[model samples]
Target: MQPAPDRLSDRRFAAIAHFVEGSVGIKLPPSKRIMVEGRLRRRVRALGLSGLDDYAAHLFDRGALGAEAEHLVDCVTTNKTDFFREPAHFDFLRGTAVPRLVGQRTDRTLKVWSSASSIGAEAYTIAMVLQDMVAAGARFHFSVLGTDVSRPVLEQARAAVYAEAMVEPVPAAMRQRYLMPSRAAGDARVRIVPELRRLVQFHSLNLMDPSYPFDRDVDVIFCRNVLIYFDAPTQAAVVERLAGHLRPGGYLILGHSESMAGNGLPGLTSILPTIYRREA
Candidate 1:
């Protein structure tokens, strides 16, 4: 009988689950065994291994994990993203937050961080808002920083290209202004304009880290949607760390579903259901 190449032995699944949860704080319960096995196949091919069994052997018996773990983590990280996702946040950012942040700023450039910025959508969305603010004569310069744990997504974010369908949520006017449609015939794709691209930067960061390697005085941080994957303790620690990065009176915006994020956390005021302001 041909081997079931994608299947993982129960022992191998436990080991992989432990490693994944420890390294990245993402749970890989027994229910996720199928998902993890499927995702690990990418690394199996990348390493020229025969199958998941061989991949597990390579990681455990051969001790190849230290060198290959990043690739392994990249495969498993969920990077669901879209342009202008959760439009209400952007509306609040533009209509209320920016003006207030500007009013309180001492620096010329407002720094915006998209923590967990999968493929740059959230960060670029922020850049578009700030650019529009300046274009509409709101007096302040702005720069956006996009950070994610996955190296592959950061590379894609830096590339600044997307399928046309992926950009559908971007309004028509912003599309015309900020996206350069692919010139190649029949290529239904677009790349963000260089001007907007220049305003945003992508970096690799793990929210599980003890400390983030970035500025502490960020004006606003969009850490939406990514926290739900973590256990409660991890979520709280990450939230506190993110709060530490905010300037006093700066904002930390969680996803709509994460409205309870800052509950009982110090120096944070729940300004909106999911929006918390750091104490000044």
Candidate 2:
């Protein structure tokens, strides 16, 4: 039997670390070295490479390997988000954030950003909520934008297709209103209705960049469960970039387990548990 490959030789590990840090500002911990190695082992074998070192060399030597590098990053990075994953954040947006902002607004439009939206669920959820709010005499124009570093996932988000299981938690009434069931090649799939798709957009964004652009001021930013992957310094940088896009008096929602206390955004005020407001 072939000997097991060396997962983390100093050179190969450094290359992987540099790729992730440069691309997404995420610093993979030493604890994850073996985990990354294990995940990529199969890919190396499939490529007819002998070990991690061989694969890393190929990644650097070939231009076509860029896509594979991206695939590796996507595979290693965590993307465990779901629709309405953090119910309280959505609740605060519907109950307090929207009403408070609308009361003070000169215009009816509300712009929201999902800073690390994965697979479009979070953005779609926001759209669904806004649709309900609009139907209930809440006359508001809304746009939900989702941004992520993973190109593959962003493509999936743009496609707006999902397994039926993904919609299970979505309220039946809303599901009926927003999703259409269809048979594609004899397999059933749920597609986001044109109305919801029109309200949301997805883009590729690198959070580490100091000068991130927002097309318009954002009223609510849903950046949940994404910051835990970064180091303290990177986290602080990301928070600052995200805060720059939020409209005054708008809200920035973080993961239930994440905090912005030490990241230096004093303008943020905790309004409802995990929900925070950007002071006007």
Candidate 3:
């Protein structure tokens, strides 16, 4: 009367893959079927379904896709990121990009966008770096905006709480200055300090959208690691849309492993293998 609990019908897996790709630009191939099943298991259990078969039935047969889609997307897209992951990017921003922008501006303000910020680590890391620059007499004020498509991760980003071990990559002085250790004895958690938290904000944004609803003249945009999940066309389109947001002379930083070699980003020049500067 029922299909095997572990078997997600190939047809349903195809449907899920299509929806994921269409909704978020994340290409989930058949090779990722097992990953999809594994991530969806908890959702299936929560819905009191016996397995992926019942879950797919609930979605497609019972007309639950519209109601369940966001949660479905959230379950699969919670990517792992760390404070100061890929430290060299921040070093480049601090040493070269910031100074270049400062020289080009009469105002003392900077805008940084973490286009795929996950759980706020990347945004807060930027704040920590910028605050240190200010302390060292870099004359500028800065704001950081962290956006992601997943609501659950955006909620985590807003809360700004992290396990103690999550902050390990943060340098000692920054850890002491930008993080607030839990007052509860034996508790191992920290919150971004109020000062740093005030400098950052988070919102939900699906990169697949034709146009973003924020400032177009962003000074620095960190869109790392995320493009890998997309197919070449989606990656190029997303990069184009992001390039549209950069101010002239602004920088777009990609993950070390990601590149724009064949993307044909017009008006953008390669600063490094992974960094591009908009034409001034």
Candidate 4:
């Protein structure tokens, strides 16, 4: 006889939801139950658990899920990203931010952090822009740090490969300068050119942490599209943390849909649709 089909019950869903929010700061409301169930069923099968309820029980079973916490966080988090997903932000960085940095700073080293970089696309995009600036006589050596909560995406981001279709938004000149066609048999992919790849570093980061692990303030931070997944309070907390990682007068770029209207964050002034600056 076949095994019984797993059903993610309301109670079980609530438990999983609580775990996710508490662990990662993502708000998975009741409406996401179905989506959560669909994504988590793979975990159930992989672990050879009896069903969704069993999986939930295991998760809460007195530290039984110890090291599995990272995996659970990975399974629940969304890692959707693309090269130049939001073009305007890149344009702003290239045109406004870089120029100001180059003219103002006596030091020629520029640092940028993509706080929620999904698969390295955004970081690499920043790299390409900086490279273009360097080619055009900008006197700065750029460094980009791409961070995410998901280990899988961080690995992918470090690998720096993407499907051809995903590279569509990358400008032709940039595609030529920074991407190399994958030569792997039957794989129509492109890898970030080594020069650009060397400019970026990837690491795992959980936004829920009380503080970030950075030792130096960066010139710019790209944290777009991540705040929407968090509740208002979480959004505010995260924005505050991100702001602390920026230098005075540095820029903070959020998603177009996210706002700091009630965040009570001090020292950040709105500059554009979703752009803010740390008061110098």
- TM for candidate 3 is 0.97
Question: What is the descending lDDT order?
Answer: 3, 1, 4, 2
- Candidate 4 residues lying further than 4 Å off, grouped into runs, are 1-5, 261-264
Candidate 1 vs. true structure, TM-score: 0.96
For each candidate, what TM-score against the reference?
Answer: 0.96, 0.90, 0.97, 0.94
- 2 against 3, candidate with superior TM-score: 3
For each candidate in the order shown, give its overall lDDT on alpha carbons.
0.90, 0.82, 0.91, 0.86
Expressed as tens digits, the lDDT of each residue in 100-165 for candidate 2 is 888887897999999998899999999999889999889788999999988989999999988888
Q: C-alpha displacement of 117 in model 3, angstroms?
A: 0.5
lDDT of 1 by residue, 39-141 (tens): 8887788788999988989989999999889988888778999888889899998999889888875676789999999899999999988898899999999
Candidate 4: 10-residue stretch with minimal lDDT: 256-265
Reference-based lDDT, residue 17, model 1 = 80
**Regions of model 3 farther than 4 Å from truth:** 1-5, 261-263
**Better structure of 3 and 4 per TM-score:** 3
Candidate 4: which pairs clash?
Answer: none
Clashing pairs in 2: none
lDDT of 3 by residue, 91-159 (tens): 999999999998997987999999999899999999999999999999999999999998889899999
RMSD of 1: 1.3
lDDT of 4 by residue, 1-280 (tens): 9976667778878877888899888888988877888888898899998778888888886465767788887888888888887788988998999888778868878899999998998899889988998998878898999999998899999999899999999999999999999788989899998888988999888999998898457899988888888888888888888888888878889888885632347989888868888886
Full candidate order by TM-score, most accurate first: 3, 1, 4, 2
